[model samples]
Target: MKLRQLASECDEGPCPTVWTIDEDAEHVLVQGFKVEDEEALATMKMPEHETTVRTPMALLKRVAREHLT
Candidate 1:
């Protein structure tokens, strides 16, 4: 599947970012820091195949304003 970048928090280097998958506009892929908080992890029923990341809300808001609309 192809990825179309929707938003990025930084101009260079590793940072929180968002992308659209193949031609599906309804769903998106996010890249951010890995979630390593033990207390937070215990609240979720995450599967072994799935993992989560941590990012600022501004990253999501930027994508929603600039790309989702």
Candidate 2:
């Protein structure tokens, strides 16, 4: 349960890998995962305020921005 910054670059939908977005849909949680695997694990979620990512990084960097707060 951590906040992960996404790369500005994306390959579009049906990508080989997938990102796990938060409940707010405002940020990424982890890098990428196989599509099949992602669905199976999507049931688990972290409480909003308690969410945290190890090796902390900035979430507002322009390289990867999440505007949905």
Candidate 3:
């Protein structure tokens, strides 16, 4: 999927690391910055493997529905 479309689906905040049409892919990428100095935010890379894996929105909705009742 296109970056803009992926971006649109996200909640209002910083951009996500990885946007994928297939959530089951090997990795879920996210875009972020590293604060080398308190006053400076430099663009940095955050690999999916480096952090906790998150449930995709589609999956979350399904799970919510299953237990909501």
Predicted model with the maximum TM-score: 1
Report the candidate with higher TM-score, 1 versus 2: 1
State every prediction's TM-score relative to the real structure.
0.86, 0.19, 0.24
Q: Which lDDT tens digits does candidate 2 get at residues 3-51?
A: 3335423456532222445555654444333234334345545444543
- lDDT of all the models against the reference? 0.87, 0.39, 0.41
Prediction RMSDs, each to the true structure: 1.3, 10.6, 9.0
Report how far off residue 13 is in candidate 2 (Å): 21
Best-to-worst ranking by lDDT:
1, 3, 2
Q: Report the C-alpha displacement of residue 45, candidate 1, in angstroms.
A: 2.0
Best by lDDT: 1
lDDT assessment of candidate 3: 0.41
What overall lDDT, based on C-alpha atoms, would model 1 receive against the true structure? 0.87
Q: How close is candidate 3 to the true structure, as a TM-score?
A: 0.24
State in Å the error of residue 26, model 2.
4.6
**Cα distance off (Å), candidate 2, residue 22:** 11
Model 3: colliding residue pairs: 16-30, 17-29, 17-30, 17-31, 18-29, 18-30
Instruction: Mark the regions of model 1 whose C-alpha exceeds 4 Å error after superposition.
Output: none
